[model samples]
Target: MTKPLISTERVQSSTGPMVIASVLNSPSERTSAPHRHARGQLLGARRGLLTVAAADHHWVVPATHAVWIPPDCVHGLRSHGPFHGWSVYVAAPACVDLPGQPCIIAISGLLREAVDRAATWGEGPMDQRQERIAQLLLDEIAVLPAEPLGLPLPLDPRLRRISQALADDLADNRSLAEWAQWAGLSGRTLARRFVSETGFSFSQWRQRARLLRALELLAADVPVTTIALQLGYDNVSAFIAMFRRALGVTPGRYFIAAS
Candidate 1:
């Protein structure tokens, strides 16, 4: 569970940079409110999925994936399920040549530990070794893989109505053609608007929405088979295949590794 929203404060740290703290909760515990920060942020989700809206793009970050938010960029953070994480601040002046896009980086065991370990030390200058370690950690961040969790949904009223109906019934198993008919648009028009406005095809967006719901269900420790059925998959294997393709790991593995 998350505590109430609190004001953002920059705390003086042992090093030259200031540290900021923010808490994340499960999707059921909060609503998505978009915002940004003054300093670069290392968004760590110890559990659940984190959906971040940065600029015109939105990213769904699962466990083992962290979003590196650059300074002065507007963004929103929301929990997809029971979530616990940290927002570590790195002063902007020291950040250089960082990827400008909202990034989804795979967390190495060592880098994850460094975050905690560095936090444990008091405000002070790091020795030569610690500074080197910090630089290496930043280097790892630059190469993180971009996960394909974002699904663009158009803002058209007719399309939105149809999309909302599908969201209301994720288990409907309706094809794009069916939705197009319901929206009173041809299949080509539906596909075109989906790509033009949302940057993804109708089929791709539906799969992501289903996957997003699946991650939330899994985080709540809901049974895999049950979640598979709930998301309209014919069987657990089919769902698992989709899940692995999006995340590069199995449901069980993701859950266990996250734990």
Candidate 2:
């Protein structure tokens, strides 16, 4: 079957900005390799989960949360399942107040509607209005709160092993102590090193990792029970509770709203 998750198109807008629009067709079985973009990008996932990577940072932007990528940052986007969204690219000058860091920002109802409207506005007499809308877009964009979404993995072979292992198996169910055993270091020493290197506690790193994977699974519409099991949760309610605690809403509500 054709890959239905990523259909890419580029267009020019009256606001003197370039727009790249795409409808994600479906999720791939394997992980997405890393990549980037040229212009500043405003990205949202109308359905499913979108994993966007930039250098050491990554953001798992769900439908409720959109990511504003500054110009020229190397980034990567991976879809969990059938996903769709628009990617608006603004020139450097038009992107003032846009973030330099990878972040997840809440897409308010107004902003979301504005984006959908902007998608249909073509060049011509609409330039002035488009410019105003663009200005409003940038102004509101600056106020968006940022949230970091990935564990900072290191390049060291030993540390990299641990990172890769965690990504490969979120349900490994191994404690840091257990992991340290395989690394031939004391648990305390390993814990300190992991935190020092990644700037996140072992538990926090693990939680971020699980949330990242969970976002991907949830976007794919994988059964909640399956997602919970894959993420090492003992029950669906526990998984839902954790998701809600982290994102401030249930997964279902977020997905439906985005759609």
* Candidate 2: 10-residue stretch with minimal lDDT: 5-14
The digit string of per-residue lDDT tens for model 2 on 70-116 reads 77667666554554665566666565557876667767777776676
Number of backbone collisions per candidate: 5, 7
Deviating ranges (above 4 Å) for candidate 1: 1-7, 11-28, 81-83, 118-137, 153-191, 211-227, 240-259
Looking at model 1, which ten-residue stretch has the lowest summed lDDT?
6-15
RMSD to true structure for each model, in Å:
5.4, 5.9
Estimate the TM-score for candidate 1: 0.66
The collision pairs in model 2 are: 4-25, 4-26, 5-24, 5-25, 5-26, 35-75, 36-75
Q: Provide TM-scores for the models.
A: 0.66, 0.62
